[model samples]
Target: MERIAIAVFITGASGLIAQVVLLRELLTIFQGNELSVGIILSNWLILEAVGSYIGGKGVEKIRKRVEFFYSFSLFFSLSLVAGIYAVRLGRLLLKSLPGEGVGIGGMLLLSFLV
Candidate 1:
């Protein structure tokens, strides 16, 4: 297979897996509430938009560093897996109080990190 095809497959697989893990984690954290789902989706789109904007502005500069991009992408995928584990453990460690859920600031931070 071509290198580009391999890269695309890896990227797609990582993204889909992360999305499933994140959605499951968020649903658990938010007690499976529908509004929480919306919040997660909105946060995802917002962050994605920001990434797109930044990538658009720096595409030329980024193209010059393909090796760096590949390295970073590898690290990112590894981190996502670790992050999923951490989130699962964190949910157990940091149990939500009655009538409490993830706040806006926490959601924003989670969205930014994830």
Candidate 2:
């Protein structure tokens, strides 16, 4: 299980890096706004929690090789891809919006994605 642990660690670390970078950029872009920023960040935190819970259960149900490291790697990759794509698409959708609603939509979608 050492290999599985390491793979999951690396994948999770890389994902955190991506998430932090984008969020920091967004914070910079909206430095003066507190409420909107809170909403944006809370969305991620809540969704990640949901993702982890769902993924943990879902991961167990999928039987893999005795060496389950492969499963970890695949799960990591797919989640990363989905997150990146969702952020990109959500950004476009939010950019054209009038206020905080589009961001709320992004958060909601992210919740289900979890």
Candidate 3:
């Protein structure tokens, strides 16, 4: 009921915010390269599908655990914030890695983390 509706709203809003953050971070990391954007978006879609499938498989087991859902949502929101910070600081942190910026593999890994 109302709880479920609130959960749904929070989930949707957080997901949208995360998407925007992820894209902006990728663009910054990749220097606005169209190819990089495509790669990140494609990988994002595939990974999201995989995640949804995995979550679906576990839904029944957690059906009675509303608290679990709430906790997971909270953790997810926190992770989004942390992930954004990590990506923002990536260049400085990885500055000694010897590159103008992170490579494709690094970018993919960062995108996956986000």
| Best candidate according to TM-score | 3
Listed per candidate, the RMSD to the true structure in angstroms reads 3.2, 4.6, 2.6
Q: Give the poorly placed runs of model 2, Cα more than 4 Å off.
A: 28-32, 65-92, 95-114
Ranking by lDDT: 3, 1, 2
Q: Write the per-residue lDDT of candidate 2 for residues 1-114, one digit (tens) a residue.
A: 897678668877987786675566454433426754676677778777987898788776766644576665677678766665665565465564534344455544533443
| The best candidate in terms of lDDT | 3
Model 3 poorest 10 in a row by lDDT: 92-101
Residue 45 accuracy (lDDT) in model 2: 80
Q: Candidate 1: minimum summed lDDT over ten consecutive residues — where? A: 90-99
Candidate 1 off by > 4 Å: 63-65, 89-95, 98-113
User: Global lDDT of each model?
Assistant: 0.73, 0.60, 0.79
Per-residue lDDT over 32-100 for candidate 1, one digit per residue giving the tens place of the 0 to 100 score? 777767777888888889989997898777655668768878888888888777666654445556457
Candidate 1 accuracy as TM-score: 0.73
Quote model 2's TM-score: 0.53
Error of 1 at 54 (Å): 0.3
**lDDT digits (tens) for residues 1-114 of candidate 3:** 997998789899988989898789768877778777887898889998998999889888875578887798888889888988988877665562433766777777667766
